[model samples]
Target chain A: MTDPARAALAITHEPEGGLVLVLRGELDLAGLPGLAPALDDVFALPRQPVVLALDDLTFLDSTGVSLLIRIANHFGTVRTRGAAEPVRRVLEVLGLAGRFGLGEG
Target chain B: MVTSAPRRLSILVGVVLLLITAALSFLAWLAHAESEENLLRRQLAQVGTLLGSQATVLQVQLADIGQVAVATDGNPSAFAAFADRQLTETGQSLSLWRVDGDDMEQVALQGVPPLLPDGGADRLTELEPDGRLVMFGILPGEPRRLAYGLMPGEDNTDFVVYGEAPLAPNGRVEPAEGSPLAGLDLGLYLGEDAAPEQLLQATAPVPIEGRTETTSVPFGNSTLTIVGASQGPLTGIQSAALPWVVLGVGGLLALGGAATFEFVSRRRAEAERLAAENDRLYRQQRGIAGTLQHALLPAVPELPGLEVAARYVAGEDELQVGGDWFDVIGRGPGSCVFVVGDISGRGLPAATTMAALRFAVRAYLAEGHTIEDVLARLRGLLDIETDHQFATVLLGDLDVPAGRLRLVSAGHFPPALLADGEVMLVDCPVGTPVGVSPSVADSAVTVPVTSAATMLAFTDGAVERRGETIDTGLDRLRTAAGGVVSRPLDGMLDDLLGALVSPGNKDDTVLLGVRWG
Candidate 1:
């Protein structure tokens, strides 16, 4: 029953001292409650530059897009890695590709 | 009305629960009564066993007396000594008799004088076999005497010994202190029937009453009937109260269940009513909003050498007054200004913002503001952060005499142009949607219009689908418009909408069309 709202997350510190957060499964309103603590911990990390891995993310909605926007707006040095085409397109249409360092979507 | 249904349901449930409680209570009571009856029978059985043993003891004593009579050759002194230890009460007797056929004569008498009549059959020896112990039956006295006789050895039928025991006056005997039969009302009758005259002793009156247990115990050759009834509950107070307790608790539980059912049903009905009321109100609001939006829009003005047509369709699932509107103003002979705009959200706030933007645009154009300046001025009417809304608009000026057209866009879909029977999307730069950012970089582009060319501009609702690229929707719109552009302007616009608008669209849409010669 909780599987739909279930999110599996992994955080790894890169050799170059950057933190990469991997997101998997659905990312929607229902998953937000369980994800809030993880997000808070990420915001507290000393690392200024953060990389997001969205290759495993199966779904994203407006709320998920809002969270991404908040993350990009927070850390100017943040960049997304392996964002899906649909994910990139949403950011592109909102004209936030430059903010997330995904040029021309 | 809601109360009526819950009340009816509760009544039905209550009746069913009450019936179940009654049935359970009755069964428990029956079982308790059965156990009580069994206990009474057991008590009577115990009394019968004790009395039967007493009868055996009497026979033994009488046989001993008979032996003494034989040893002493019927000496009266020997008989008196044995009889002295055998008599139990003041109104009792013991004697030794010589049985000659059916006539028995007493050899000695001890205690009270024997009640046997002279010259009468001993009755004890008449029916009983030679040496068997037998009942002599009751004798009349202040207190009745119960007599028994035993001849002893079968070889000797001549000598017989008889004994008698007294009963209480009025057939009532006070139970001994601490007697086990203390809790019972008991009656001991001489025979199977508890006849008043045959009752030898009793704790209560002549006959025990109410659910009595009757048991028979052997007394010499006859049987004594012991009839008994419990003075109170045989198994104590808790057992007596158990059935009532079950009934009480069952009744409470049945009531509780019915009340809970009523509460839940009432709550559900209330929720349903509230939901229906909300729906009715929502539809009413939508109707007013639709009417208001139509009133705010201008009637299409006819222009010389030009054809104009437009449509406004509210999405099936869209809020009543979402921001979608179109305007066409006749500027003079062979020229007109057209506008198509869409606001981002829904409801009264979005509708109000849309109205403000529309009137502002009309004022700007009426003041002779250039199409580019007019599109730019629309930005000042709203701020997305404050209103949480933005408008995507397209404006065009068409001149049929010069076959020229000018177009400007504010983050809106590019207008479709059909010229020489070829369909193409206008190459126009889209500015940031108005009210989104403080300042936007934009301009107007003029393109020469071919003779009798038709141009269509519309909102994203005409092509927008969730999770899909807007370009695919645009391509679809372009193809659809191309197929129907050959028809008259009104038919063309209607067909395009029929082809492009899907029922699942949740945003209102507006389409503006202009045909120039």
Candidate 2:
């Protein structure tokens, strides 16, 4: 595994067996350049249920929001399931969490 | 890249070229004139040499005593002997002669006619007497058209010969073979009526200097006159070369001038285009900032029975558009809901967070949530909805009939109290900025509408900044709110915003004011 400073993804698995991603800065047109690789890792994992937490995220713009929606839409519940409360809220605000079946179910 | 240097260099080069061309043209013209002068001078020298040779021949023949006496006394035998000797020695053509005596009588010797023609006797009698012989007549019956005359010498009693020689080619005489003037026109003339100045003036001036030479040679017994004039007009060859040189140089100069003009004009056009583009980009950046600020704020919500007024001011600096917002919701029965919030940070992200907070407050209020419950729910909603972006807000419900105001403060500034021509700050407990935590603790404060006249709620940016602390802003806000408390609430809001929030406020400032009788 390669470690790059502020490399687009910084994920730490919590003691409760959930993944917590700390997105400290902003996600704008500039930040979109390296986000694809991190998101790919999330979708390529096994079908086991996992909580994708975005609690440490300080800023998320429309570009970031759109990427989240596209991930959930493309990978329906059969392959990917469960997400943290904050991430679910962002998806609901964008009106896509229900379609992906990732909230409360 | 400095255009002026190249431009000046080009201009300097052009001036130098102009001066050089002028000097060259003047020199060329001088050379042309000099060439013509050389041609004329060579011709004159040749003519002078020929005249010298002719005079020597005549002088030798005249020195012969036999030939002179025979020609003067009209002796055929002596003339025949002299003519035979001259033919054998000099190979010259023997010509006409006239003799004058001391008695002013003249005689024609051999080589003259045997019988006089109609006007021949008068012509022969016209010679001068006293041994100063004079002769002048036109020869006839020959293609050469030669004329000859002889006058006697002053003291020696000898005669003089005057003559017009035949033209070699056309009317001009030709120089001898291998002469410097062999191909030139040597039109020499000598007489009292001939003007030397007129001939000299006909030729163009040239720079050559050798003084005129004079030599006297014998002709019969009198001296033959010889004068050389070196002058002639410029030939076609010299005069024709100027126009062609001028045309060629002038065409080159015109082409260079036109190209330089076009290059300068094109650069000027490019400069104008760059300036216009810069102006357009500046304007577009300004518009983008303004749109972001507008998007974050709430549209003014209409509330019944309560005179609610709000004003928002955006900073003037280009990079400083921010997130400050206010909203009023009508809660039915002469009561209404009001809020003023400030999102953390500046620019677009702050604006987005403010938008979420504002809508969340309005939605909770519409669902019949109490003022305190609405604040709690809004805190929870933002904690979940936003990443870490937070908003500081004050939410209140006004009961117009009950004459009471209930409010929940989430780390927001306390409201300003206006009463009896004085302004005071209403004391309230502060809470943490909303969305900082999932469970934010908030404090509810209630103030009676009795004798309070007007209440003003505002974001920190309305009366605060980096220089002035929160207390100083509160004091300034209180003073401003005192003057307008007696007037209508909407006008008072305008006056307060006009006084404290804008034209100079360096951040987005949101203000909401309400009054109840």
Candidate 3:
């Protein structure tokens, strides 16, 4: 059986110099390997706005939130949208929603 | 109790099994040894029987030669022809002697020398009527021989006939080549005496050790003793070694099995010890968490014309101290601010966050802030302090004398109202959980509280389970609260909690009841 805690990352480059990364499934310690390469690819791109779409994410642990914060720091114009309730809760609790431009319509 | 009874029983069984295995091996070995000894004895007896029969055959042949000599009747030519014929017919040598005035002359001889020496003839002359003498002796150039001499009837004038046959080295009548007793040491003694002097022939000169079997054969005037000795004990290679091998292997297998059992049991005992230690630590931490939760929760205040009661029950999982909590602060003489909130996580971190939010709400209320203003400020507090911790809270301002209640829900379960024997949940506008966003606005709903009406507020733990929907738990809470609204506030809470809370509920629960009188 596949591990429920592992996540899958899909990154798409928009024509407007923006990258949309969609994170699906649980983003726990088991998911870190799949996330690391995608994150590295996002960092390697030329300076552009990155949008993290977390609508499909089922769960997010503290380590995953730390990684998201790191991603935001890498690309200064990063915005997060479509966060599930749990992800939104964590972002709000850590006070990162406003800093990362999360929950914007 | 700490000493395992099963382990003790297993050890006892192992020891018993080992002893049984050892005993069975020894018995098997013993049986094989006994059978081997019996085989040896039987072999010795067989050799003895064979030797006895060979001696009988030799004696009979000698007697026949003696009878032939008697028939010759002292005639020199007749005796010569008779002796030569006997020598050729039997495989023995023969001689004829004539007795005359204390002297014996060998008148006829064929294939053998005279039975007596020239000077020893006087001894034979003394022979009485039909007298016989059997002797075993070696000729000068021949192998060992058995000779028999017989005198014909009482007249001293008749001749004596002597017949002699060659014997094997061991004195056996048969040749050693085809003899069953070939490989064994044997001795033949004449005249029933087995002493060294009487031994006529022997294969080996050494005295036989251990046991020997003897058979006796009666010759004409002497008894022949056939003594047979085995080469060694009758035990084959497989028979001798099989018993020892079984015993050794059985012992090793028993030891290995017992050792394996001991190793497994020791590991089980160690695992049990670790589990027990972990359980003890979990309970201790649960106790500390419970204490912290109780210390941080405020007691229901005594507001006039209102009966206020609140209960906080920790979750069944002793290690998981959850974040469910409640607080009641008297806002003014006839008004009170009551709050019930649940943090999203468990253990110390959740408990800490619950305490922070609870106290912050009280501080904001004491400063005369509205319910929405207090929630807004709580959001700010959670956002600044906690990294991944959030709470859902239902805050209310109860004005008892005016019979009015104002409620603000921040992603929390709405309170249920029981009035006029009807129970219904108070649906209010829900903002995102306090930590989600600082800009999210919270709106309030004001409802009228009739006389003898009850308001029930609780965390989701009071309703939610592993697989069931949240609505099912809410419906159950409504049914329970509606049925017990007429009872005293404390008893009502007891009944409601008993009906709403399930066994093995993994989350903490906080229930608050405000009965307007």
Top candidate (DockQ): 1
Q: Give candidate 3's TM-score.
A: 0.66
Chain A TM-score of model 3 comes to: 0.82
Query: In model 1, what is the error at residue B340, expressed in angstroms?
Result: 0.9
* Candidate 1 chain B: worst-modelled 10 consecutive residues by lDDT: B117-126
Docking category for candidate 3?
Answer: incorrect
Write one digit per residue (lDDT tens) for candidate 3, span B1-517: 5447547755776777678777877887787778765765576567656655655564454445555555655556666665565464444677777776677777677775544433355655655445445453433334545555666554433666666766555443332686765666667677675876556667655354445666676645566666666565456667667777777777777777766777787788788989999898888777787788888888677877667898888878447688888988876656788888987666777778888898898788879899999988898877513456667788998886787889987768778988898998987766666665533467888988776678899986787654444566777888888789789889999988889888877667889988776
> Per-residue lDDT of A26-70 in model 2, one digit per residue for the tens?
443346566667767765755443344454444443345544434
Structural similarity to truth (TM-score) of each candidate:
0.77, 0.54, 0.66
What candidate 3 gets wrong by more than 4 Å, as runs, is: A1-105, B1-17, B20-24, B74-232, B236-242, B298-303, B331-333, B364-370, B384-386, B465-469
Question: Which candidate would rank higher by DockQ, 1 or 3?
Answer: 1
How are the candidates ranked when ordered by DockQ, highest leading? Answer: 1, 3, 2
Query: B204-274, model 2: which lDDT tens digit per residue?
Result: 12112232222333333333333333433444654548644854595467458645755775587668668
Considering only N, C-alpha and C atoms within 3 Å, which residue pairs clash in candidate 2? Answer: B128-B134, B133-B151, B133-B152, B150-B160, B151-B160, B152-B159, B153-B158
Better of 1 and 2 by DockQ: 1
The local distance difference test score of each candidate is 0.76, 0.55, 0.70
Model 1 stretches with alpha carbons more than 4 Å out: A1-105, B1-31, B117-119, B122-130, B247-309, B315-321, B332-335, B436-442, B487-491, B515-517
